[model samples]
Target: MSGVYLIGAGATPVAEHYGRSLADLASEATRAAFAGLPEFAAHRVGALYVANALGDRLAAQGHLGAYLSAAVGLRGVPAVRVEAAGASGGVAIQQAVQAIAAGAAEIVAVLGAEKVTDQLDDAVEAALALASDAETEALHGLTLTAQWAMLMRRYMHEHGYGPEAFAPFPVNAHANAAKNPLALYRFPINADKYRKAALVASPLNMLDCSSVADGAACVVLASERVAREVAAEGVPLVRLAGVAVATDTPALALRADPLDLAAARASAHIALGRAHLGLSDVDVFELTDPHGIAAALALEAMGYYEPGAAPRHAADGAITPTGRTPIATAGGYKARGDVAGASGVYQIVELLRQLRGEAGPTQVDGARVALAQCLGGVGATAATCVLVAER
Candidate 1:
């Protein structure tokens, strides 16, 4: 297998692009990604991978790989779409890396785009519900927020805590987002605001949930030889050290422990191992936080904290960029806006910024190794990747 390196990354700000189609958003990102590389050749792009979850339901479009490829002027390349619910972007990255490693493609383009805000409120809810168990959960009207709220309630009961304990997750995310130009919610919030926020579901307030947004993110992966050529031209190379994906039972009711997040743990463990590193070696983490409780569960499951203690870490400000385990450095899903399939790519783009020392205000000083993990359908699927800056 050959090594793969990220040579370019780009993203559109997470917001309501009222008149932009999915292809338009993706094309903009792709153009930005190629803008920095003077040697970029469209014909050299051997394959195109597009990640999206709701294009058909929300945008009335399908075959996004072909659509986006042509939109970006890569019409004849082997193009395909990757869908794994919320983990679609990360899984797309995983596939791109594999293609480069296996010599199937020397240069691959991965684009994750989602148009989520264009649909009606009820239609958006229905499309999101497709990520959950259709027969058992969605059929019974178990919306995504409700499932997360149930988990939060159970977590509070088991840990003897209250809803306020999870406030730190959103507070920290918003604070970080305040410094990120591409973030949707660029204002900080206090614990008081969180406590007083309107409830979307019991124990999970509106502030605790990620907002739906429309956006796209893109990254270019190259073989070791191509990466060296790019680096020779002064482009900073960020190595794709490791990547892995894992899955769990689709139905939450079937899990032995609803909050375990076994898939996250498994993917993180494998990715870290492949990177020849440990938890302590990771300088930054970009884990999914669609809901505050989800962040807590992910932190614990990824071994950043003891089970049931992640909330405490958050409350104590341990997850801040200057803390022991800095997470959500780019505002994360809570405040950055969750564009569903595009969120994972957003995380990777943020990590690349951190690695390149380009994260203006949200930069993690001396950050060398970064980990990004995205979860799909509650905790049913996970994709994890470890990246290292060239020394």
Candidate 2:
């Protein structure tokens, strides 16, 4: 198969952009991505893949492909919208890579954008709940937050842990976000602050969750054939070494084991297998984190740590920007605020900065390979991507 290279990427600050429309955010990110390549012409873009999970439900707009393509000034090209709840961005990137490998297009542009601040807080919560299965999950009034809470409770019961064990995840994220200008929460947090946070669900406090906000991220990919034609100065070759997504039962009740995270595990194995690398070979990992529990489960399921060891690893400062197993170097979902579907794209942007040695304070020393995974809901869907910076 032909390889796909990440040419450039961009993103907007995760915030309540009530005044900006989805098109505005998407176009702004696209412009930033294009700005990195002054010699790359707009005519070379063969397709546009826009990922947005809640544009119609919250913003009264749909067909983001046509909307954003026009906004980005791309004409006479194939354009489409990709949706898979929060995994939409990662899935869209997968689609673009497949297009390039199949010789359908040499250059593809991917944009993940979401607008939710237009609605009231309650309305936004209701809209975000669309990630749940309508027939089995949402029908029972189970929100994503409550589902994660259940996971946290069960993990604690099985592992003999306390709520304080998970505090390091959010605390680390906030500390990293304190240095990220694009992060929504620009302050550091400690375990005491986390312990005192108000409870939203049992064992899940307000600090345990991510704030939903409007945001956009864009990335341009080209076939290896085209990549060699262009020179990206001061950086090594960043290739999409492998990409895969896996699915499990959408209803939490139907899953063989609710805490297994089988989909996430399978996706990670497939992606890493194709990359010919293991978790230890990855310099950094970026897992979607709506809640700290979700990230802990993903880390274990992806074989990064023992089933009950992820929280403890966080406590050891192993997940800090320059730690042994660096993760969420760009504040992650906790402090960057959850951009929902666009978060997958934002993860890529953050990793690209690390690979290029452009991440000032958060730079993982000598980052060469990275892993990022985004989940749709719980573990119903997981899209994982492995990137390698070839020297």
lDDT of 1 by residue, 1-391 (tens): 3388999999999998988888788988988788787566455899999999889999888888888899878898999999999999889999999999889998999998999877877888889888999999999998888999999999999999999999988998999999998899999999999999999989899899998799999998899998898888889989999999999987899999998999999999999998898999999999889788999999899888998899898888888988777887889999999989888899989999999999888788899999999988897889999999997
For model 2, what is the error of residue 275's alpha carbon versus the real structure, in angstroms, after optimal superposition? 0.9
Question: In model 1, which runs have C-alpha deviations exceeding 4 angstroms?
Answer: none
Q: Which sections of candidate 2 miss by over 4 Å?
A: 232-235
lDDT of 1: 0.90
Whole-model lDDT, candidate 2?
0.87
* TM per prediction: 0.98, 0.97
The C-alpha lDDT values of all candidates are 0.90, 0.87
Q: Give candidate 2's TM-score.
A: 0.97
Model 2, span 233-352: residue lDDT tens: 433468999999999977788887899899999999999998888889999888887678988999999988899999888889888977777877889998988988888899898888
Candidate No. with top TM-score: 1
